[model samples]
Target: MSTPANTITENPPPISTGVTPQRLSTLRRWNIGLTILHLGQAAAMLILANNFAIPVLSAYTAGRPGTIGLTTSNLFDLRIGWAIALFLGLAGLDHFLTASFGRRIYERDLTHGINRFRWLEYSISATIMVIVISMYWGIVTINALIAIAGANVAMILFGWLQEKMNPPGRTITTMLPFWFGALVGLTPWIAMAVNISLLKDENLPASLYIILIVQGVFFFCFGLNQWLQYRQVGPWRNYAFGEKTYLVLSLAAKSLLAWQIFAVSLFS
Candidate 1:
């Protein structure tokens, strides 16, 4: 007797719906544009921080007992603009490589390879985090450490949940490094501001003012663009924080931080 057809079972092969070369080229263009923008902003900030802000503050309180210098020479003895540019350039390259590799794996239907890459990404990021924290140990204050740790923990947990619940796309793999690098790129500025504030000198207020203006503008623009892009491409966009909420919250945070900094500049 012939076996019933219903008793047989079959599983379909995984589909290979990889990203095309044209799409990759487009993404590369976008990434390059972002890199340029980041570099330009960093250059402007360096000019403001080193040339304009420092000289003005120094001149204003030249002989004051509690006044201190705000120049790059005094603060870190490092070129802030070049550092930012280098970090951003590396970040852009990381994003591009990750995206390209992911696309190739998808095209080849290499599930195991994709998982391996994910682990490697996490490992590299964690290593970099350790190195950064160690490098800035004395410079980074307790409050800044707490803030950064908290933000990173939240991001990590959220990413884990995302991977479990919905997995990730090629786009996310690319964007993750860029976002992390952007956050890291802000560290130097943040550290300097904190140092100046803690010094409790006459120039502290002016230093804070410059940081507020520069950071406020940077975060506002970057956060807005990220929010918009997240709306367009985020995996959980439909379920979690919708596009409007994301954009509104990001902008609101930027404004609130700006106001706080302004208040510190005025009253501190």
Candidate 2:
């Protein structure tokens, strides 16, 4: 049979790890939907930032305790909602760009069995969370705050490597990188816990505990998602399943954090 002129018969190349056009379409829709959700949440948080935002304190210590040139550290207070907004919006931007540019933006990520933008978002958002926790526990020294952020960012990057170095068809038999990342990620949380404990739980805000529990649970879920993906457990055998799970996790984590903060700082 002779082909008709200008007939579209050839299939477009898949984006990211040989994802089919159908899968790519599904992913694009998923990105669009999640982007809307993230942006919506971010907008709400931003609006609330003006009056309901939580206090985030930053300090600069002039010298070590009891040392010469020691000066009273000046604390700078910032709004927490703004941080939340940025966190949510960064992820929204990731999804927005992914959906908008489709293949061009997501090709590398999908090809590598990872989302670089996701890790990048986490690097910022998760760092913010850690910083908030640190300040809440009075770990406000500039050096300590920087270390916390650096550790969190490093952990997130290691997570990126966890996927980038072990894509599908590569026979990924171990998840050492993920475990190591988790270990590294534990620093800030553990430090927070120690600080809380040392303070003897005297007059601490109940919201602080709530934040810890909620964040801890979601952090575990994030690790579980990656582990399931690596082990190819059940539905996770499909890369798209893992991807979808990640999207859900991201949304749930951000939403829970935002609402929890809102409940304490705004609605209360």
Candidate 2 lDDT score relative to the true structure: 0.77
List model 2 lDDT by residue over 162-247, tens digit each.
Answer: 98778666743568889899999888888888888789656768987888788888878888898888887888877777787888
Steric clash pairs (candidate 2): 16-111, 17-111
* Candidate 1 residue lDDT tens string, 113-190: 122332333333432332232222234333444455455444434333333333324334334543564565455446
lDDT of each: 0.39, 0.77
Model 2 lDDT at residue 13: 34
